[model samples]
Target chain A: MLYIICMVAGLLLSRALRLERIARPIGWAQTAVTLILIACMGYRLGSRPDFIHELSSMGLMSLLYCIVPSVFSIALVYVVTRFLLKEKKNGRNRDSW
Target chain B: MVILALIALLIGTLAGMLAPHSGMLAVLTNATDIYLVVLMALVGITIGFNEGIVDKLKRHTLHIIVVPTCIIVATILGGVVCSFISGYPMNISTAIAAGLGWYSLSGVTMTNLVGAQIGTITFMSSLMREIFSFMTIPFISRYMNYSSAIAPAAATSEDTTLGMMIKYTDAEHVVVSLLNGTIISAAVPFLIPLCLAVF
Candidate 1:
């Protein structure tokens, strides 16, 4: 709930203020925040010891389990968007669909 | 920017690997979401600034309808196929996650509603979908017009990728993509939970 509110607030505030022109600058700021957050996450993780053992225990199956759905989803999106929708338009050929 | 993201991912992964407590690792993992949101917000602002909402609406009305419609349809089909292929019981959250091509919200929601294992699978799969989208955008766009490419690009905005889409793709498409993506992204957090609860 709070997350949703923050997102909505940020979006509304940014729009209300006409912060679009300075988007790149804002982007940089957001990027900085993201970096810091990621760093904090990493620091927190590094401070723990048992995480390594658990991750190792999962091993190759973990990688496969994580990767398979992603591959399948992308393939599905591509095939459906391309062949099924028949909306495939390259740069050279602009067909009026 | 891509390099920076890769560095962050590496650092996060390393931290997760090194952490002793699962709770600490979870915090680190959640940080990725924070990073993603901030990046997406900036992407939205940049897109909004470059292409005013009114103009973007006028330009991409068709695309806005077409892309999400396609994605939703594709997601439903994909979920069914995934359920059958994986031999796992299908549910709404997994379907939506597969459809949205990102698990961050849907996976977590499913976990809360269903169980941790399913949630983990959804997250992994959705993460893969995001990575795949990032890699294939250029190749896919090569065969697509501005709108189709832009809509999904906007739909899947991340720190490293949205800027590339904007820089390389048509302005109208970028605007449409951003707007469309923002709508879907916003809905995901709420809708995923609702879907999980209801179904």
Candidate 2:
């Protein structure tokens, strides 16, 4: 949490200093970090002694669990955005309130 | 820059694969979250300071906020429906986990709570969400005002998308997207877990 706060503060300070060009570099850095975090989490998961057995037991059920929520969320978002939002002259919708 | 980050991520994954000890690789892996948050904040500040961002927000604040809200709501509803259809108890915690693709935080948090497979599912789902949002931004913008596109686009990477939106679309959308991303990202850590616990 403190780390996040420091990061936000640093960015704000950078912006105040007019260093807008640095944003992309910073963003790329963040992406790299996020990937590492994911890998670490994977490693931790893989290291557990029961993990393989648990995974095997999960089998097809695991796949279903994963796919169902994901597809549903994306489809839901798409449907609502498409149906509820009014289209403009260009067939584009405005993105405000 | 995204390319560079991707390369770095590739290298990290490879290192993890090749390493003798898993924990050694885990340290390297965990670094990505810190990098992402800092980078996102920097992107946010840049967008926040842009004059055109404010102008765009003034022009289309309503569209910007509402569209993303609709998308998020849809995501939640879909999660619920899928849970029911799959015969798995609806796990709101899991749905919330999938909703925030920030991966580093939400993924870890879910792992600590629900176990790894579920966490992996959340991580992958979130990644998909981000990628989908990123790839669709241009197409979405063509149909909607840039501000509206910013909402979902920023759902993945505020800084990267905001920059792209500013360069390619309306300036006002860039600022509004940044602001919106900031707010949503902040909520993700807590909301995902809460939602997971609820359903």
Candidate 3:
């Protein structure tokens, strides 16, 4: 709820304030935030004794469960989008949008 | 960037284990939620900051529809196959897959709708989805179309994972990703319930 609001506010604010000059830096900030979020999640996992104990047993299944879906999604989307992009490669409509 | 991000996570995990300095680490854990909000706002600013993206989005609007449909179908199919191999019911796997990458919601929803057993699997699997999301962003961007790279992140685009996508993909994909995130997030309530009801 608030997340959407803040994001919309930021977007509208940027539009009004002409913040394009600093958009690059904001992008860097996003990467930094992502890194911090990932590390924090790792730290939380480490602190959980139950998770660590169960981690060994669930390791392989967990890996399979995670990788397979992502691989499938990527493979499907990649193939279709590649065909789409290739079709649009001709100069006639290139970069028009 | 992905490697460095993983290294940072490794170090944070090691620190948490060695120190268990619950005081500071607890604060850090709580702070992540706040940080997430800030990041989302920054993403909006970046998106709004770009004046031309709206035009780009209009041109590639079809992508918003096609790509997510592929991801959703693939994810559900994979989940069904995986459930069969793992000796679970197809319904359980479908609900889990329907979670996309939003672990917290999936975890709780599965637990309440099903049992703790399936719920635990949902939590872990979706968490893995998120890890894979962060892991694949750069690699996919390099080898595949930027739009497809967003597949791994699934539902995180509205929040935690959006940043990396914006960093790796182009302006147009970001718009698509935001749409993907919202759609997947919205789908959660309906789809998870649908999977459970069918079971």
Candidate 3 to truth, TM: 0.61
Compare candidates 1 and 3 on DockQ and give the better one. 3
The per-residue C-alpha lDDT of model 2 at residue B167 equals: 62
| Consecutive 10-residue window with the lowest summed lDDT within model 3 chain A | A87-96
In candidate 1, what are the lDDT values of residues B1-199, reduced to their tens digit?
4356447645855665565456855664555455556655654454445445676667556556665555544455555555555555555533444426444445444444554445444544555556656766676667654444443332465333566577666555555566666655665666555545554
DockQ of each: 0.27, 0.28, 0.40
lDDT of 3 by residue, B1-199 (tens): 5465557657766766776667977787657558757866776686675456566557667776777788888988888778877776888778878878866556545655675445556666777888888888888887766777889988887667889878887776778788778667656656777776685
User: In angstroms, how far off is A10's CA in candidate 1?
Assistant: 1.8
Candidate 2 residue lDDT tens string, B1-199: 3444335434543554456376656665455445546554654454445545566666666555664565455456656665665555677434533455564556655665676666655655555556556676677567644544554443554655666666656654455566666656655655665676677
Model 3, residue B138: distance off in Å is 0.5
* Residue B98 alpha-carbon offset, candidate 3, angstroms: 1.3
Stretches of candidate 1 off by over 4 Å are A36-88, A91-97, B1-6, B9-51, B84-89, B92-127, B142-154, B157-175
Model 3 reproduced share of reference interface contacts: 0.59
First chain TM-score in every candidate? 0.70, 0.52, 0.59
Q: Per-residue lDDT for A1-97 in model 3, tens only? A: 5566777788888898888888678878877875776566566656655656765655566666777788999988888777765423111233523
- TM-score between predicted and true chain B, model 3: 0.70
Proportion of the native interface contacts kept in model 2: 0.23
Sliding window of 10 residues with minimal summed lDDT for model 1 chain B = B151-160
